[model samples]
Target: MKLTDDHLQTFVEQGFVIVEDFYPEERRAQIAEGIRQTLPPWEVIADDPPARRLLTDDFPYADMLFNEFILDWDLIAFVQRVLDTEDIFFRYAHNWARYPDPGAEQPGLHIDNGNNSLLPPTSDRRYGQISTWYFPEAVDENQAPMQIVPKPYGQDLSKRVLLTVPAGTIMIFNTHLWHSATVFKGREGQRYSATRIYGRAD
Candidate 1:
């Protein structure tokens, strides 16, 4: 979906914007099912080193389901507008399953710039990278919503924005934004999300 003036302003001020109702429930389910089919059981991955390595080292784009979802024209156009560039390239894709862990604590907030680029962020955001996470499952407060600190807020924990949205929500954020994953407090099902990263060609 195209970003409106308000959405663009939010991204400019907060460094991130959540786009919802863009992908239909059916399409989201299809892409999610593909990921779940390939994903090994969490227990199996924990116990098997080879299984874990294979998953961590592999990219999900090999599957056409994921490819179509991430390569959709509308999504790319939206990203291009945000980066203000027609030259953009796909960086990577990964799927994550967040399950309930009894004593696990939320990790520290950090920018994606560390692994995405060597140079620091620019004032013009010309070299900025985009990290888009498509959530197939509706996220609730207790279901481990992503915590993001607005660009102007620095590392203040109290100023964090919790992303609690419906299914089929795609959140696009600049890589320089500080964010962290909170622990899953729900006792039942796990939360599923897939991320696709993109960077400017120049």
Candidate 2:
């Protein structure tokens, strides 16, 4: 679906906006399964601590389903609206699965600039890069919810947003936003999400 003025306003104020059910469940399921299958065998990773992170590099190139999803016109248009540009370049993509790891330390909040972009980040939304995360299944608090700090709130712990959303949920945010991936607290269940990043062509 196209983004509305309210979405723009929210992005301007909070540095991000979450779009629920951006894609159909069936489509998301296919993408999720593709990613899962691309990963190493669960039994192998389950015993290897480092393998539990399950982050893939250049994942879109590994499968046609991922390539199509990244190139979908509707998704591009939605991101265009957020960046206020007609042309944008796909930066990169990766899929990740977070499993329960009570020993895992809380990740630090950081921006996706520097490494994701060649230029320095700007406060202006129009010139900022856009990053999105698509969750194929519901993400509850115990399943490692994403943590975001709104623009106005800065680093205030009280103002942080814990993204506990339903399946097919997509969160679009400025790459300059301060956000972090929380540890999975649940005893069972995995948190799988695909990420895509884009930047203004100019």
Pick the lDDT winner. 2
TM-score of every candidate: 0.86, 0.90
Residue 74 displacement in candidate 1 (angstroms): 1.6
- Worst lDDT 10-window in candidate 1: 48-57
Q: How far off is residue 168 in model 1, in Å?
A: 1.0
lDDT of 2 by residue, 12-93 (tens): 8899999997777778789778877865433547666455554564754668888777887777787788778898999988
Model 2, runs deviating above 4 Å: 40-44
**Candidate 2 residue-wise lDDT at 200:** 87
List model 1 lDDT by residue over 46-94, tens digit each: 4443321224314655677776666877777767878889998888878
Global lDDT of each candidate: 0.75, 0.80
Instruction: List ranges where model 1 is wrong by over 4 Å.
Output: 40-62
Q: List the residue pairs that clash in candidate 1.
A: none
